[model samples]
Target chain A: MNRLLFALPVLVLLIIGGFFYRGLDLDPSAVPSAMIDRPVPDFALPALHPGKKGLSTADFGGQPKMLNVFASWCGPCRVEHPIIMRLAARADVEVLALSYKDDPQASRAWLAELGDPYRQIGVDRDGRVAIDWGVYGVPETYLVDAGGRIRYRHVGPLTAAVVAEEILPRWQALQQANQ
Target chain B: MPAAKLHAKLAVVVLIFVIGVSGGSPALAVRPDERLSDPALEARARNLSQELRCLVCQNQSIDDSDADLARDLRLVLRERLQAGDDDRAALAYIAARYGDYVLLSPPIKASTLILWTGPGVILLLGFGGIIWVRRRRPVTALPPLSAAEQARIKSLTAADQGPQ
Candidate 1:
């Protein structure tokens, strides 16, 4: 009994140590999105490009697509530009972009310089629309199913590995479900 | 100095340290334009902002964060207030969009019971363990000293007292 009493503190310490050890491997910055499996919030904004129709929540219902929140000033958005371009090229899914809290002229110049990859670009000058979408920061991507429900959310820059492993598989699943 | 006076001085120093550490630094990040004209509504906005977490900063309340997202949240709160939504309604609108994680004080529910009560439960268990250990400890009674040993001890005490 006394021996067990002596061992209790050590056991508790080991349990706490195990939890901390597991926490070390997890990404502290990755906050779980609350928008998953919910309908995309209502928003109507002007187009970033001249002489084009503005994007809205109504635009999403007809197909499975991806909505990317990005800004001209956001470095991580620049990092994921190529991947977004590649995703745009795919026929299975449509890619839409929201220029979050960015100057429309700057956003246009950015797209022109980087190569335009978005099917429709919405200008969120004041970031009010982005707030409705529960955007913490720019460079977040949401996968919307054909029913206009948010299926998955990816925070931070999209890497080639994430595209192949996480995004592609999820997109495929959503596509199959639609079929 | 006397011991009581020294203790009072020490307490005063500690009080000063605490006041210094927790003084009204007003780390408010609310921009001038964000403030409502009506003092009563502005006060409500400030209180509401303090309860909402700044998603970008993660650790800071929107009232205390300079992050763009935090600023956006503050603006939204004010907009909601201006639109005639009450405090609970305004908060609910944000919470529906951002989830419960955005609230500084989470509501009490089955899901959060452990988070709320874990510390208190741990403290009770600690006190209980201390009491249990003390109760279980056997106090051994000392054997009576021999007359010879008592005499020797008395002699040693006398010699030590003489030197003192």
Candidate 2:
């Protein structure tokens, strides 16, 4: 009993240290989106391409799709652009794009250079639409389910690893549940 | 001068500076263009912005941050107020999208009760620990001095007294 009493403080210290150690590995910058499981906030943006139809909440029904929020000026978006292209090519999920706070001309030129993989592009010129979407930064992605509810949101760039790991598992799970 | 003295001087300078600047007009980040036409509406907007976190900066409130998203949030708050939404409705609109994390001081709720009470709980635990340790000391105290040990002590004191 005395030995146990002597070890009690050490045990408490170890537990507290364990919590702090776990905290060190956490990314403080990744603010989890409050919009998850909620319906895509209502928004309609102009077409990034002159003739193509723009994007909106109405565009999200009948299938699960990925909405990539990116800007021409954002560096990480370019890094993730190829992965988006690959995803679009697989034809498993409809990958859409929101051009956040970007100039249309610049966005068009970027798409021409990078090879546009988006099914439809929405232009959020002043970034007001992004506010409703709770976008704190560029290059966020939201995976919306068939029922127009946002299932998951990734705050930073989407990578091939992320697509394979995070996106695929959730996508598969969502598909099974739907069926 | 020694390092400790130098640090003391610097501390005094900082203290004086803080005291000197304590009562000045606060520097608001709200740009003139973002302000509503009506003062009452603008004041309400300002109050709401103070409660909303600048998600980009995370630590600074939207009213105090100069980040682009902070500016956009300020505009959204003003728009809501101009449209005649009450303070509760205005805050709820922003909170709906950004989550409770966006609120600088989130209201106490089922999810937030722990956050609000954690410090106090730790304080109570600390007091309990102190009391337990204090009380346990008596139970685990050194055994009473033996009779032989006491006699040896008495002889030692007698010898010392004689020498003195």
Candidate 3:
């Protein structure tokens, strides 16, 4: 009984510590990027447009670019798809999309439903292309400058406010700086 | 009970108290440096923040993390809250921009039915295991000791009492 009394607290602590250790181990959160202002990674993926060639790193050069990562399974991708289409209509900037973790047919169907505004859509079915692009989730948009340097990144759905206040101004500035 | 026993109990209590206090307090110092003003907005932000996942940290809520991206997400959340977005709107806004991966607790959609119900299914299996084990383990009966066994037990007890 005396030994049990002395040992009870240690036993309780082991249980508590087990839980705390589990929580500590599960510290799921994004790592803040160390890659800002750095050159974007090279990528080559099959084009969504039939009979057309895929996208490459050279596409990012000579033009200010917006790379939107999205998938059919993502609901937010539907909401942001129209805004991306609007952004793509501008000749001043190139809009490229990386279709992540999705079937090519599904992506085509989604684009068909939402209307593809992407000048070039690259399929990254296994997400390796997204990893190389430093993508954490779908619907992330990164603005790369004319020199292929990443200018800005928005992690979540792009809306009018985010577009006007953040993406457009930064893109315009990068484009003007190049000229 | 007795004074020595009380003293012994007090010592054990202090030891356990010290250990418990030290264990849980380490995480409190890791607050993100971001400023969140507007008490009403902050309250709403806090409540809504936990619903959103930090993409880099897949399992953790933006509110619970000190990660830089988590801080940025918190700022985004606050921006939406201040701009008159309700909880669902704010979540949907972020989701629309970032994807469903940004939600800490995923929505009740067909794709997420298994994820939402898996825990209950696992619990039921655990309870079923307990019931099966109880049924499998028979009501154990102690064997009857023979006369020789009783005599040996008596002899052992007498030996413990020494020479008498």
**Cα lDDT of model 1 by residue, A34-153, tens digit:** 789999888898998889877898988777889899999999999999998888888776888899999999999999999988889999999899888888887999999999999999
Off by over 4 Å in 3: A1-31, B1-164
Q: What is candidate 1's CA lDDT for residue A125?
A: 91
**In order, what DockQ does each candidate have?**
0.62, 0.70, 0.06
lDDT of each: 0.90, 0.89, 0.78
B1-164 in candidate 2: lDDT tens per residue? 69999999999999889878895456778889898889988888888899999999999999999999999999998888888899999999999889988888988999888999999999999999889888987667789999999999999999888954
**Candidate 1 lDDT, B52-123, residue by residue in tens:** 988888889999999988988899999999999999999989998888888999978899999999999999
Best by lDDT: 1
Interface RMSD, one decimal, each candidate: 1.1, 0.7, 10.4
What is the iRMSD of the candidate numbered 2? Answer: 0.7
Model 1 steric clash pairs: none
> Model 2 over residues A55-115: C-alpha lDDT tens digits?
9989996778889998989999999999888888875777888999998999999999999
Scored against the true structure, residue B92 in model 1 reaches a CA lDDT of 89
DockQ for model 1? 0.62
Q: Model 2, which residues run further than 4 Å from truth?
A: B1-27, B136-164
lDDT of 3 by residue, A1-179 (tens): 65775796799799989989898876245434434677887678988778866677877878788888898998898898778888888777688888888889998898888898888888886675565565776678888888898778888799988899999999899889888
**Candidate 1, residue A53: CA error in Å?**
2.9
